[model samples]
Target chain A: MSDIKARVSFLGKSANILIWLLLIGACAFVVTPLLFMFSASFMPAIDIMKLPYPWVSDHIHRQNYWNGLRGPDGSFVFLRNTLNSLIVALAVTITTVLLSSLSGYGLAKFRFKGRNAVFMLIMATMMIPFETIMIPLYMVSMKMGLQDSYAGLIVPFLTNAFGVFLMRQFLLTFPDEVLDAARIDGASEPRIFTHIVLPNSGPAIATLAILTFRSQWDNLLWPLLVVQSDEMKTIPLYITKFMAETHSDEGIMMAVAAMASLPMFILFFTMSKYFISTEGLHSTIKG
Target chain B: MQYNKRFSMEQKKAVWGWIFVAPSLLFFLVFSFYPIFNAIYMSFFKKNLLSLKPPEFVGWGNYVYLFHSKTFWQSVSNTAVFTIGTFIPLVVFSLMLAVFIVSRPRFQKFFQMALYSPAALSSVVAALIWLLIFDPRGLANQTLNTLMRTSGVNYHWLSSSSMLRLSTIIVYFWKYVGYFTVVFVAGIGGIPDYLHEAALIDGADSWKDFWHITFPLLKPTTLLVSVMVMIQCLKTFSTQYLFSTSGAPTRPIDVITLSIYNTAIKDHNIGRASAMSVLLFLVMLILTWLQLRIAKTEDVTYN
Candidate 1:
């Protein structure tokens, strides 16, 4: 009995070691390409293409960033594109948070006729892929003279059904007695929302805001259709253009990719807890 | 007087509800509902994107043309190949990765953060990074050559038909595997601890306990992940688009969305593009409905 127990303990120890090894390997697999991108961003183009490809640069070359940002004619096209992406993403995020919270509150708390029908309508649209409707949407944008402008990008995606769903699921569990007390104290519905609902909805708002911002920042298909001019191009388009013009220079392409991904990385690192939260994941999948 | 006052209060609440939901409803009506209906309507008309003339009605012409077109069929097959090749491996490996992460409580957060790093990248950025890796004299070939003890043997990651398809799959898998793993981690976390304890008390080992208890309890999450993966794979556009534009052959990787993009933007064939989109929408709808039906039957509610 003593010998068998010793063998069992030894087997468990080996299994634990194997698990750690597997975890490290998986992490490395997920991270290596990113490491390569960062390393390549500072290397010369030739070094990047050399056999036994250079994992690190001998010297940190800042020239690639300068060249990548300043276009062939020295116009800061990449910077302008980054600004456009920021503006669109911020506008969409702010409006989506405010509007989604309002709708989510109303749908979750209040009793109203046609509420379910309205919700069903919105949820039905979530099933329809944006590609299926792009041609018509493009036509609509053209008719409204919204093509080639920020309004064209910002207006169409102000709020999505998924945000409302997330917010509603969150607000459903909110205590109604607080709102009732506020109402009994002569507070209007809007006042109750601004003062009571918004303050208490930190997690849901943060989750929705981050998701909205990331989606807008990374949006490619709709922007590709709406923005025609070089001036209105967003980061994705800018990167594509840079890749095309500087096909031979892997360093410059990597530089552009690194710069474009910086904001998302920062956002993810800061609010990652919300991203992997069981509540958020549960609501997202429960639908 | 009391009845009238209560009636007015209920009416006031209902009015406020409408006031709150109005803006989003209007936005969706114009942006989502209108476009979906309009796409279906426009599929019957022959319209040139650049032409100022009125659209000429040609009911079912575009659909018939698509059904017979070899390029459309090729795109269909390519999409099927991409979806099948990617989603199965994605579901399997991400689940495995999730199990590995969950098994080790100490490293769960660290492992999740590391795996989910790539999902934060935009599809364009993801593809751009992979493009460098897939270059002839890049990391992909170097690693393979070193592993196999071969010198300067090019794998043709971008040029060959099968490898090109595989390259796109690799990028997508690398980007999303962590995301779904995180989702799976959340799913597995939802399983109650008492069940595991009971299994252990019954002399069931970890493997048997997982197969009999955790896997069955995780049915809803698995269905959700599979459907989400399927839908996302069907809608894959940017990677294939970027690869084709970067001089890789378009024929092998031209999925439906990319084909729709080319038809609309390159060829200026609005009617044809609308028809293709409608067909794609039907596929998504059918898949979503199928999932819902299966979910209804297989739902495992905890008492």
Candidate 2:
């Protein structure tokens, strides 16, 4: 009996070791491409393309960065593309925070007719794919004279359903007595929101800001449809060559990709906890 | 008199609610609801893009043309194949990965952070990484050749039909498989520890315990992850769009999003694109409805 018990313990230990090995192996698999891209961005054009697989550059070369920024034919500037993206992302984030918090506060605090219907409508919008609405939104932008302008790129996405949903779900748990106390002290609703509610909802606001910024920063499709000029082109457009004048060179591709992804890596690494927090995210449909 | 005082307070509350919600409602009306309705309306007309001519009324003509068009059919089939191929393996592997992370408590955060690092990458960047791996004599092929002890395997990752499809699937899976893993881990983490202890006390082994306790309890997370993954896969455009334009065969990778993009922007056909959008809209509506229905029937298993 003692011998059998000892054998079982040995088996359990081996299984534990195997699980750890598998876990590390999967982590490497997940992280390798990003690391490879970062490393490959430093490699020269010849080393990037030639065989024997240069995993690391023999000598660091920064020309790829210059080549990428100089555009494919050396006829354009990549800074403009990045600037366009930054402007759109920042606009969307600030607007989303303001609009979503106000509306989410309304949905959570007020006892009003049609409140349920309004909330349901906003939640339902999350399910609708953008492809369904692209053409009509495109037409609307053109008719409103927003095409090829910053307004066209940023206006449609300024406020999103997900932000409202996130904000509302979070504010639902907020104490009602605090607002009542503010009201009794003669604070108006807007004043109450600006002073009392906004200060308390810091975590939700941060979550929304990070999420909004990350998504808008990575936005591709809508911008692809609206922008027409070389000056208005975004990062994905450069790599995909939708607005560019020449095909992407192999080294330039790595460089542009690395540049495009750097801001997000910083954001995700710093806000890793918020990005994967599962409370309001996974349990959206609460019982 | 008493009724008047109570009713006035309720009215004041109602007015305040509308005041706060007005901006968001107006934004949605113009951007979300109105555009959806307009997309439906535009599907029935023949509107020439880049022309001042008024749209001609041709009810079902665009839809009919789409039904007969070989390119549209190919795109629909490609989308279906991409959705099914990518989603199943992704959902299963991510769930297993989540379970593994949950079992090992010591390095849970470490593995979670490592696995989820790729979720932040844009699809364009994700595809660019794989583009290297799929090159003729690139590292992926080289590694496989070395493993099999063969030289110059010469598989066409981008050029061939089947291989091109597989390459796109790999790119997507690499980017998002970690994301869903984190979601599942969160779901599994929410399960209380007492149940596992009870199972162990009742002589249940690790595999049997997971099958009985963890898997059943994860229904909500599984539903949420599957729905999100399905919609995301259906709406995938960047990888497919970037792949074809960057020299892969456009036909095999022509997803519906890419098709809509080309029709509207490239060929200047708004009506045809609107027709396709309406169909996609209907499909998403059904998927979402299915998720809601399934979620409602589960009846709060934990409580």
Candidate 3:
């Protein structure tokens, strides 16, 4: 009986240790790729492919960043792509935040015929995949002579259904009497919206802005189709093309890839609280 | 007299409503609603993109051709395989991870951040990073060799068919599991604590409490995650696209989206591609409806 007790105690301790080890291991597995990309970016070109896995680039070469910034055929073209991504993402974020808040406030506070139907219209189309619409969107853009332009790139995705839904739900939580009081004080609807609602809805606006910016920043297939010229390519397009062009220079390619991921790192770290759970984005829809 | 004045005020509010929703509504109408009908119209014709002549109306010819095409069927099967492989693991493991993370309150944010960061990466970069990992002399092979203690474990991830399918699934799994896990954590968090406390009072163990209370309560979330995973798996492209273009065997990794892309963009067969899109959309629509119906029936049985 004493031997049995001793065995059980040892087993319990081992199990506890094992569970902790597994948790840490799982976390490490989740993060390995980004770490590898960051480390390999700093590795020497020759050492990138060396055996035993250069997990953390022993001989760090800071010049890899410079080499990667150099586009195919010695043109500083990659810079243009990075700039294009930033411009599109920022534009989409600002437009989405403004439009969604106004529309959300209108639907929540103002009584109108067809409001529910309009909201339903947006919700029903929410799950429609972009692939189904890309071809026709491309065709329409071409017909309108908007292809390969910044307008084509940013216009279609300026606002989404989820944005409207999120803003409406958040604004619904705020008491409505504040706006009515503003109206009694001789303030116009637009003035009340701009001053009262917008100022109060900071967290919700940040949520929409972060989600919109992240999705736009990471957009690829649409950008690939819309922008044909190297001058107009976004970061994903430029890097993919650059990678295919210079397949041999991997250290440099990794460096470029790392640089491309900088916005994601920045956006994620800054807005991480908003992103910690889908509760921020999900629960509002049903509510 | 008072009633008439109130009616006028209601009319004014309606006008303001229109003003507020106008811009976003206009954007959606042109971009979303217009394309939906346009794609349907294009699917009936032999619309070759490079040709100047107007599309020749083929009616259901593109659909018939797709039905007879062997490669189309292959792509359907490939998508199914990838969906099943990735979907099950993602749903199961994300749920488990969510449950585990919730148990450890102190490290929830740590694990959450580590997992969620990958979701922020562009598919292009994520695929590139994985491409490096799966290289012949990369960490993946090195670890495999060391563990097996044998020198002859070459899986030929890019060249072989089964291996290529598995590789794409792995790429997607690594990218999205954390995202869905965070969603599940939020879902689980919403469950009232009293149910678990009651189970404990009744002498139910943790496992029993989870199975009886937590799992059943998380039905809506599980459904959402399952549906999302299914749709995303079906629509997968960038990684598969990069793989084929980067010299991997294209046939093995030819997902439906890739085929649609090849037909429309590369082959310039807009009619065929549009038809494929319509069919894929129908599949998605029907699958979602079926799942909802199944859930409804289950609720009847259980409740």
lDDT of 1 at A20: 76
Off by over 4 Å in 3: A1-15, A278-287, B1-7, B287-303
**DockQ for all models:** 0.50, 0.45, 0.40
Per lDDT, the best of the predicted structures is 1
Question: Per-residue error at A191 for model 3, in Å?
Answer: 1.3
Q: Pick the candidate with the highest TM-score.
A: 1
Whole-model Cα lDDT per candidate? Answer: 0.85, 0.81, 0.80
**lDDT digits (tens) for residues B24-65 of candidate 1:** 888889888888888888899999999999999999999999
Off by over 4 Å in 2: A1-14, A72-76, A242-248, A279-287, B1-7, B294-301
Interface RMSD of every candidate? 5.2, 5.7, 6.9
Clashing pairs in 2: none
Worst ten-residue run, lDDT, model 2 chain A?
Answer: A1-10
Model 1, A1-287: lDDT tens per residue?
Answer: 01211111213667768867877887888899999999999988988987777687787877988888886658998899999999999999999999888899889988899999988887777777777888888888999999999999999888888888778878999998998898889898999999999999998888888878887888889999999888999999888777777788888788889999999999888888877664324445322
Interface RMSD of 2: 5.7
Top-scoring candidate (DockQ): 1
- Comparing to the true complex, what docking class would candidate 1 get? medium
Output the worst ten-in-a-row residue range by lDDT, candidate 2 chain B: B294-303
